[model samples]
Target: MEWKGRRQSDNIEDQRGAGPSMGGSNPFGRGSGGGFRIPMGGARRAGGGMSIGTIIFLVVIYFVLKMMGIDLLQVMGEGGQTSQPGFEQTETASRRSSAQEEETKAFMATVLAETEDTWSGIFKAAGETYEEPKMVLFSGSVKSACGFASAASGPFYCPGDHKLYLDMSFFDELANKFDAAGDFAQAYVVAHEVGHHVQNLTGILPRFNQQRQRMSEVEANQMSVRVELQADCYAGIWGKYTEQKGLLESGDLEEALNAATQIGDDTLQKRMQGYVVPESFNHGTSEQRRRWFKRGFDSGRLDACNTFQGDI
Candidate 1:
């Protein structure tokens, strides 16, 4: 939380005002509310026609969400879905966009630096060299090796690109909607995504993906839970660096724990629909998520993050 004066990362690609492209059912269809909806609150520029304002109304949102070469409407013409990239002077991109975006970006950069330092030290300790990854920042939607993604996908790390993707509006959701507001809470999000990058670098993600492809839908969903849980633990390990920097505020841990619970597959499902169907779950239950994150926070050891163990 004490991230001021920390170094900012130059790896960011600010595509906040990019063009739009409409598309389908979340493509991979995770927890996104629906079309044109930015996951949480950062799905590109949800502009025009004024449907839901929460980053969920903007047409052509597919350009940001799932992104994967999905662009349809060329020019819906304003009322029907204008083709132009909606660059309206909205409050989000404006000055009122909260001082937190800059702070969060800086914090994320600091966290990245710490991860680089820690992981490098870790690899060196293990007689290997660490490969650092970059973080990409965009608003509305942006394209990547993983394809186009609206803020609807939330923050994710694409192993294909070896970079972490984030939309700062998610930080706003962390504060206002989820009530999991805290610098560390936001930091946890970055760390968790970066954790995915770590998993990719360690060959865990690919192995999981390969195995998941061979498994039944139910089994694959379970595998995703393990993967997500391990990422939580990794986030906790990254969080250890925060403590070393004297960044632990009293409510900080609670905020992060709250976040772990907030984005649970169960919680999100219940919020989006009405009930929780375990079969359709991929991210894991709230308690499961909280436990894994706590496990990582308590141990700060990479080995302890093995959610893929036989028992997981």
Candidate 2:
């Protein structure tokens, strides 16, 4: 990719060394794996509401426990469980030098700027305004509106805050561990999360979250696959626009496709557990991901990227 000297986005929030502490509480739940998340419903009080005195007493007790070195919220967050499994965690290699980190940050900013331009144009053409999302750059773990997440969760877009949370270390794992290396491959990861933001803006994510409330776990997982594939398709659309501007070089498309293949739920499952369970698949298979991305790249039309209608 010819990204040098290109315009960079100003919406980046660099919190590489200032990630959230482990004791923090995540009331909503852990964020989803890499992609769009279904907003988890908060626990509701049963048997009507508590009295004012009871509420005040509970608040006082909460602070008392905190002063005594106990966090009820943290305990609750830890106890909360979900059937959905997040992305696998891998040991990141030693951190890159300062120079390399800066370059990667610049590259990410430039890629973000490209997506902003592409999506802005597309939205304007459809008589809608595109609101650009902020990208948060953190190191180990970060607290988001969705919840607290580590780099193992990979790069994800949180609809609650309309922001993309990323840890650059994941890119290292993507290359060294997953064998998907290249600047364009890294760009694909960013584009995929940004695609989730686009879904949120289009009401797709909100509708999905609302519907998933009543859906069975298996049914929700199946629907999640479609949502993730659509994001991949959206990423491909950005790639198409980038290519038209003569930014994509030889093998860039393959780099992105390989990255998509490497991170597919099926491929990761097979590699991690030496088997695959189709029922637990939230993201699509390797072939499905690659195909959907190519479908968007070839057509470059919003309607062509619809994975929910008919066959994906």
Candidate 3:
């Protein structure tokens, strides 16, 4: 957990306060206008004059969504609008980072760098070049190639864009709401998402998607469980590598294990809904998650994370 003064990844996109309406233009650019212009690609522009009734209706809908805590800017491109060419097209909002938020960002960058180093070596040993994925930092909501997502969806890896999206507030929620705390726990989350990128690079994700089309709901959910469990195991593989480098302090492993358990499908379902549905459990149970992570940590081999091969 001692990441200070360590190498940091340069692939981080700091979209903390840039909202979607700003279009492909840099949302972080200095501007006194809160509203930014978004270029529409072969789509209807927003300049048409509206009747009073239409404006009133839209205004009411806006207020209703605001009451529900929905971000209006994030919905701009969700209607299938494509960005103009030459624009990065990340729909994000700009906001000032708090002292703690800045520290968390630094930690995330350092952990990403460590994962890059460890995985690069692992991939090189396997006679392959690792293509490191970008990690995006956002607040509230963000738009990606995969679609718009809110922080409530938690941290996710979008294979379509080959990037990991994170809302740093999730770390606070992890500690306070899920009872999983510590720097290592946050690192575990990043590693797990990065593990998804690894799966994407190895063709496991595409194969899973192809096969999932032929699967029943329960079977597809089971396949998803395998995918998620393998990511957890991959996170543990990174944990093992960091431990070898003397980067992990005492109790760091426990924090990650606790995090895995706390976010298990069964534990979360029971806590939120008072019951657990096995057929709907896409990420495995707490025991399964903890066991797979430990298995990878103990063996430190990619082959040890073959969760799809047999019963997990």
For residue 171, give model 3's deviation from the true position in Å: 0.6
Compared with the true structure, model 1 gives a TM-score of 0.73
lDDT score of residue 57 within candidate 1: 46
Evaluation by lDDT, superior candidate among 1 and 3: 3
What TM-score would candidate 3 get against the native?
0.76
Candidate 2 stretches greater than 4 Å from native:
19-96
Q: Using Cα atoms with residue i matched to residue i, what is each candidate's TM-score against the true structure?
A: 0.73, 0.76, 0.76
Q: In order, what lDDT does every prediction score?
A: 0.78, 0.91, 0.91
Residues 131-227, model 1: lDDT tens digits: 8888888887778898988898788889988988888888887778767777777788888887898899889999998898789999898889888
**Model 3 agreement with the true structure over 53-106: per-residue lDDT tens digits:** 887999999999989998686777653345432133332212233667888999
Q: In model 2, which residue pairs have backbone atoms overlapping below 3 Å?
A: none
lDDT (tens digit, per residue) of candidate 2 on 1-312: 999999999999999998447677665568634555544655345745566788899999999999999999998666553322321121122233676899999999999999999999999999999999999999989999999998988899999999999999898899999999999999999999999999999999999999999999999999999999999999999999999999999999999999999999889998999999999999899999999889889888989888898876
Better of 1 and 2 by lDDT: 2
Off by over 4 Å in 3: 20-97
RMSD of each: 17.8, 18.3, 14.8
